[model samples]
Target: MTAQGLLGAGVQLVLVVAGAPLLVGLMRQVRARLEGRAGAGVGQPWRDVRKLFGKDPVTPRGTSEVFRAAPLVTVATTVAVVAVVPFVSTSTVPEPGADLFVVVALLTAGAVATALAGLDTGTAFGGMGASRAITILALVEPTLLVAVLALSVRVGSTDIADIVSATLADPARVTSPAGVLAAAGLALAIVAETGRLPVDNPSTHLELTMVHEAMVLEYAGPDLALVELASAMRLTVFLGLWSTLFLPWGVATGTGVAELALGAVLIVVKIAVLGAALAAAEVFVAKLRLFRVPELLAGSFLLTVLAVVAALVPA
Candidate 1:
């Protein structure tokens, strides 16, 4: 990597760390507006993080070392994911294998670590949350994998870089019926994976309705901050992946300075629009009954499978 490339990568790291909170803040602000309530400022999440960092952590009695290490592992995985995911542009940054499958796997690793930590706490809520989270993961993962397969089949490579390049090269791929179906499926998956509404509400603290929040209720101090920040990073990675794969209109294909700048701007705009849409969704839709959650995920799976079949059709 040239100096500029290295600098761009460093910029991505900082943004993932800082911008993740901003994304969460924006979502909350928009959701509040949709509900006709004055939302918390976009800085609220940052404030929460700062507070968590300053407070001293109190470990639950009998908690193992696993409980202590889980938060760090989770954050590290998410940070690494931000590096691999082509957020600003497909042409920028370094990727291993460029495979969409690899990106999905890395995300799964982060989720698994957090879920295990949840179980490690030995609290009733934590175990309950972990079980529910695993159920959702089981339902969502296959659909994501299948969707990637569908996209790979169309573009003739599982590599995301090639996939983006193919879409950019043709541009007409955007209009393909199969592509549209996959986009819809992927959008739903993003909501589910990120613990967004109609799946699980990220903002809720009610134990009965909580999934992700329930898992981390016992965490305190810097450990809590790491988990919270990891959640934010997870959200950003999914949004960034979506931007690169489906709406990569402007991204650096090489190390060109101007192209990288344009790519960065485009990424910001896309995520802003997406965050607003997510906020609007949360305002209008209630969380699905926990039992009904499977149905929703199953619907996404069927749609993705249909998309794959649709791609096989001559267009």
Candidate 2:
């Protein structure tokens, strides 16, 4: 790998690992203020994670190794994606893992591991959460794939870096009808995938409505910390990917120190702004009924389909 690629990868790894929780905290703080309640500062998530790590781990009896391993697997997969995806710079390390399909597969593997762990718990809540999570995943993965594919069609490459670089070269592509539709579809897919509002609420602990938190009810201490950290990282990664794909104005095209530094700052700003906007929007909306969730996702899928058609057919 070239020095620039290595530097880009290193920057992404450090930024995602350190900034993910802060992003979560910022979103929470924004929501809290909008609702007229004092909120914990942005550093609260960092404190919570640190406290969880210091606590003793717990493993319930009758649970298999899958239960113990799921958090590790999830974190590992996310870390792998951060390493390969061109989040901070397009001049990233040359690797086959940068392929869109491979990145998608890695994300899916993490979800599957978490689902299996939920089943392994043998608890009713765990099973219920696992089933719900899988159902959402079933709908989400296709939309995500097709949405990105719509963008790829124009560039004729499934490599995320190539798509970003192409978009950079042809700035007009971002304003096309296909681009608008794909962005809408991709944003919705990310919301569902990250267990955000209307599809699933990250802050909810209510048994009937909780999808992700339900699966992790059995986890405590360090295991819980890993799971929480991974969840935050996934949200950040998706947001970062979204910004890199659509609003790629500031992403580094070369390995120059100045370019990389600016890219890092801009990405962090983009994600934070997006996170705040999402939180603000959530304040005005309520979670949908379970059955209605599919309808919402299906609509997003349709948008992606239209995006593909729009991309393929000449204007």
Candidate 3:
């Protein structure tokens, strides 16, 4: 690997792992202020994660090895997400090499790992969360894949670097009817996939309203910390994908350090916009009842189909 590739890969991983907590904290602060309450500081999530790491972990009795290993596996899968989706640059890590299919698969893998861990504990809440999560994911995964399929169809490639490079070269490609629909579809899918409002409430501890919390009910201390960090990172990864695929204005096509730094700034700005938009949207929208959630996802699926059809049209 060239020095730039290695450096770029390392930077991508660091941003996802370290900076992810800040995104969570930012969302919380924005939500709180919008609701007329002073919120925790943006650094609060980092403190929370720190506290989690300091505490000792507890393993549930009678649980097999999977329960014990779930946190690591979940975080690892999330870290893998940073590799496939370009945040700092269009270039990918030389080893795994980014592909659209691989990106979708890795994103799904974190949920599957956690769901299995939920069932592994033999706890009712964990099992319930896992089941509900799986149901939601069934809808989410297809929506995400089809949305990307629409994007790939336009550029004739699934590699993030190639797609972004091509789009940069011809800014007009992203202005097509299909691109608009796909962008909208992806926005909805990001909300659902990241467990945001109108889908699942990340702040709610109530099992009745929570899809993610239920699965991690059995986790405590650092184990819980790992799960939470991974969750935050997962959300950040989705936002990164959004920034890169639809709005990759400053993403580096060259290996120059100066270009890479500018790309980093641009990516951060895009993600910040996404975070604020999500916080604002959550304030006005009520969480959909579990059954109604599918309807929303189905709408995104339809949009994806339209996006692909629109892409096939001659400009």
Residues 62-175, model 1: lDDT tens digits: 788888888898888777767766666564456454578877888888888778888998999999999999989988999899999888887889888788889889887766
- Per-residue lDDT of candidate 2, residues 180-248 (tens digit): 999999999999999989888888799989999999999999999999999999999989888888999
lDDT of each: 0.84, 0.92, 0.85
lDDT (10s digit) by residue, model 3, range 90-203 = 664465457888888987888888998999889889889999989989998888889888988868878777888888998877787888899989889889888899999888
Model 3 poorest 10 in a row by lDDT:
88-97
Regions of candidate 2 where Cα sits further than 4 Å from its true position: none
How displaced is residue 184 in candidate 2, in Å? 0.2
Judged by lDDT relative to the true structure, which candidate is superior, 1 or 3?
A: 3
All candidates in order of TM-score, best leading: 2, 3, 1
How well does candidate 1 score on lDDT at residue 282? 82
Q: Which runs of model 3 end up more than 4 angstroms from their true locations?
A: 92-96
Clashing pairs in 1: 91-252, 91-253
Instruction: lDDT for model 2, please.
Output: 0.92
Cα deviation of 150, candidate 2, in Å: 0.7
Model 1: C-alpha RMSD to truth?
1.3
Top candidate by lDDT: 2
